[model samples]
Target: MRPHTLALLLLLLATPAATRLASAACAGEKFPAGRAYAACEDLPKLGASLHWTYDAAKSSLSVAFVAAPAAAGGWVAWGLNPTGEGMAGAQALVALAGSGSGSAAPTVRTYNITGYVPLGNVSTPLDFPATDLAADAAAGGRIRVYGTLQLREGMRAVNQVWQVGASSTAGAPDKHAFQPDNLGAKSKLVLAGKSPAAASPSPAPAPHASGGGAASSKSPNAAAAAAGVAAPVALVLALVGFLATV
Candidate 1:
């Protein structure tokens, strides 16, 4: 390859690595802009963690729960109780292990937790966009389950709980695994960002006529912005690398 061509190829190769580094840094901390959670709390007892982002502007709530790996393939369930205490009368999202060919994506079911015994029956799924759910292998022969829930509601908070099982027939017996037990500490849905009503309108700044040019690149905020701009390019390079390896 020509010297300049080789240099260009090397630059291209570095692009993906740079992008991955940036993404990894943001991993659990960031979600899709409007979809990201303001907090991620660990459920140590259940070997799981929860992340949530609330958009007060749109009255939307995005939730993601990751459970510890279950080698035999199991299930993870998250419940939201509008009334408070235990799992009774809570809306639940249960993710079960995929079967056979379609196993890459775990099947998700919505339920209404009724009765003191926590008998959850199939209920209406949320009207919001369908969530992305999957199970993947983790270190030490464990399987990790990841899922997201998007909800549109007026409530500011709700009591939450999570459960996991050793088999796919977990949660309700009609579903899979055995009965799922609560995993971690007390959980709830709390809004993070500013509410629409709390935000005050600010007048737009007048444009400067003098050609002072753009702000200094060395400025801390400017550097951060530049890094954000480069993120997309890095992601593209990472994709190219994966395709090349394939």
Candidate 2:
């Protein structure tokens, strides 16, 4: 066989196993010492994950939101939407790396998003009560936002929105990308019952400048299907690299 042909065959044979390993790594995620939760789920978008425990009696929720920013000095946010399912009307906790100063640690802040504007500038109160908000860097360059929220009475499930941005400005979260994964980042989070509940997609308001203000909803399957396409494209790129070398 030609050198490039042999390389292409090897890459094709390895792609499935590599994909499986990547999926398994997310599935078997482990928390740092002293950070434990009742359940966790690998979210379908943005390569994010959530570990949470809900207290039914106290109507409290403890959550650790985990995701990597799009680049260094970027930010990540995870939030709950009490009034709606999309980014608008959601209570978000944003994490940004701290500047290099004395005792300059990572920080997490709360943002009550009223619209699809830039999140860094909007620092308002959420609809519900939240406390113990903190952020820190984790292994693999991922940022973790840890907080406990006091939900309304009888809120068994919640609409969740998560995002990762390319950069932040002056300790504020910048706007995240509008890629398919970013747009499809919102989902339904079940607080109780069996673990790893199937995610239900929510209808987000049409993003600003995407024409006019309307409802733009994404199917859960569409995100999953788009995620699957990435692996094949990556394999093809690797094949092309091998061919160039040959």
Candidate 3:
């Protein structure tokens, strides 16, 4: 193949990887309905997945949880640790199958945690199922629950946990199925929109004499540096292509 053609082919082959890296770094990340955030899915022994996004301007935090439906019909609970610790002092949202006219829809209740007990009736009608959860129920299955909550001052960071339980009937006694039970293992909820630190300008390198001998072409450092430079160039090219398509 002609040298120019070979170079063009190599550039084209690098474009996809570059585009993915660029998107991951700078594009707005979205949490898909009914799925765990990719960053939290790998937590050890995690049975349920939670995803959250915070809108600082609106002072709101939207959270979603996804877990397999209990075979015998039960409840799924997500809790927040105001102190960033254990189940104690946690605020939980519990979703259970409803009864009577709203039986088809799941009902959500809020509780303030103390030890193993859920105290107080903080349950409000604000919590509801996501569209995917509704669709799943319509198709004879249930898998997801989502809702938005007002973020109080200094609530930007907190510990979070999930639990699943078996309940014979709606509002019946619940049998715990899964709970992390360890504050150390609980996941964290971090709000978005924090400003990143500005980078200090790097000093320009001293210029070498033009008549000096060229550096060794086979040097490992030289090759590595060249590879690093090429990667960003490829990313820029891929980003340009993506913007053009948009």
| Cα lDDT, all candidates | 0.48, 0.70, 0.47
lDDT of 1 by residue, 1-246 (tens): 456755765676466434444433223432322233334455544566665444444554445666643444566667677666665666766666555664465556776666545334343564343344444443433334333445556666667776765554333424322334442334654443222211111111122133111111122332343465477576656756665665
Identify the leading candidate in terms of TM-score. 2
The lDDT leader among the candidates is: 2
Indicate the worst ten consecutive residues by lDDT in candidate 3. Answer: 195-204
25-69, model 3: which lDDT tens digit per residue? 212223343322212222233345554444445555555555544
Q: Which pairs in model 3 have colliding backbones?
A: none
* Model 2 spans > 4 angstroms off: 1-27, 101-104, 198-246
Assess candidate 2 and give its TM-score to the true structure. 0.67
Error of 2 at 217 (Å): 36
Q: After superposition on all CA atoms, what RMSD does each candidate show versus the true structure? A: 14.6, 12.7, 17.0
lDDT of 3: 0.47
Model 1: CA > 4 A from native: 1-38, 69-71, 101-103, 116-154, 169-185, 193-246
Q: Tens-digit lDDT track for model 2 on 62-126?
A: 77798998987788999999788899999988888766651355678888889977656546787
